[model samples]
Target: MSTDVVQIETRESRLEHLPISFFASVMGLSGLALAWQKGVHVLYIASEWVSLVIAAAAALVFLTLLGLYGAKVALHPSHVVGEYRHPVKLHFFPAVSISLLLLSILALNMWPAMAMPLFAVGASLHLVLMLLVLNSWFNHDHFQTVHLNPAWFIPAVGNVLVPLSGLALGYVELSWFFFAIGIMFWIVLFTIIINRVLFHNPLPERLAPTLFILIAPPAVGFLSYVRLAGNVDAAAHILYYFALFMTLFLITQVPRLMRAAFFLSWWAYSFPLAAVTIASLTMYEKISGTAFFVISAVLLGIVTTVVTALVVRTLVAIGRGRSACPNRPARDPGRLETQ
Candidate 1:
């Protein structure tokens, strides 16, 4: 009876502490699926089956997360509401919708029947989540520049992602609507984040990985705009080249980033690398450049390695019970600002 009691408590604890950021794993896995799907079409080296398997895995993870998070809401309404109001965690609620969006893209090719519904639900939910997060920022008396990080870009990235499948599904006006939101906010957040990073105290180890997220908006925007406008014109050039430069710039910081203690935030590395990989493949397809092909192949290899490591580490953390260790502090330190 005591053993049963202990197990029940442990399970409840796990549910209570389950981070909204876990949806990022779905984002990473889904991005990997899409990148591989694009790779097979562009590189012609891998079987599409590889991507299909990844997409299935992503779908399973998303469903599992959805179920678990639903359970959390039911069993631990206080914790769920707490996360909803959290300064940093508030930005993550959209991750649920973003996961749905990414899965929609993945399913578009594999299970056409599932695509539109997922897109519709995901797109609608993300808009609501984004507005809520923005409202919190606008009205809050507590938010500070210290709370700013690349993860703040999460909502904006989801907006840009809308156009990829949205355009192909013939939502031209809707796609542009999303693309504009993504672009406008990307520029705004980029400026704010740059200022925060340049003169401020360095982001603590946990959030350092989110710096990789800076690569995603432009990389995804490039792909979306190219598809929407039907050409790799000057605007596409600006987006793609900016993404490529950010990729190059962050690669130089890999050594420092690698030294950070493992956190769920490390999954941040996966999706951005995957975004750049798909963007590179798209560039090669459009421009017929061997250099772009080489970049895509290299990035494909790197993202695959990074995501595989993250999965293993995460599983290992769960097995060791550190994934939600009660003593662990997932929250960032308070009051950090410019030097």
Candidate 2:
């Protein structure tokens, strides 16, 4: 009691707070899911309102933070928006922009008077602009060729896919105008993506894997449209082909990127989930028998398990002071370790 005591303080991690990008990506995902769940009243189960409200809240929160980050990134004298450290040009801008608009439409579920028109306009414009930005590299003659930071492309594609369920939802309601416009935009965007992957990027070796993950948006849009149209034959064939391609790509590429463990680990863990989800969504619409349903269910379960594990792992790592730079170790005397 008479002796003096020494105290120790521990700092909390910034990542535990969740980065704006992550929040934005999640909102985009939730919005897409809700949009897909629009019709099937049974699908909503119990907490549909709660889910929509939460998604809307996430959308606004991320939008505010992303805006601030973008402004800060833009104002930097040395760094341009397309550069590596802060690659805002890729899909971040378009994803968040469309996300907010979509959330508004979703929140106005009962009232289509304003939401319907806005959703159509917003999705069409957003899809076109985003495709152009992503595929702009096809214009090799441009003054500067932006070497995309895969970080932007990866999550951004995921973000794009997040809204895809909207097409399905609208289709269920027989909102022909929105459905038609959205599909047209998606078809065009898909063409651009296909072009860029096939002709633009120099990294042919990297192309398939990246495209494998990136192509989910158009795949999703296509599936939704076909399902909406009740063209099961086409949808089933496409799903099978897509699954085959994805499986082949994943098997080949995962080993190639083995040296890039952290990045590859993230990719390996997340991408298969995406591939399966897209594949299952497509197959779910197509096949009638138990075999198809079982396969689809299994794939969906795998996707859910893998993604949830990754998210929890990421969050826990954040909590333990490994947050932003999880790759860094306490023993390492690097800048990341210092952070």
In terms of TM-score, the best-performing candidate is 1
Colliding pairs, model 1: none
Candidate 2 is scored at a TM of: 0.55
Q: What TM-score, over all chains together, does every model reach?
A: 0.95, 0.55
Tell me how far the alpha carbon of residue 209 in candidate 1 is from the true structure, in angstroms, after superposition: 0.2
lDDT of 2 by residue, 65-114 (tens): 56645654545423323322333324434545455454544545633465
Which tens-of-lDDT digit does each residue in 1-339 have in candidate 1? Answer: 699999998888888888888899999999999999999999998799999999999999999989999999999999888877777878878889999999999888999999999999999999999899889988998888898899999999999999888976889999999999999999999999999999999888778889999999999999899989899999999999999999999999999987766788888999999999999999999998789989999999999999999888888767766544222453332211111
- Compared with the true structure, all predictions reach lDDT values of 0.88, 0.44
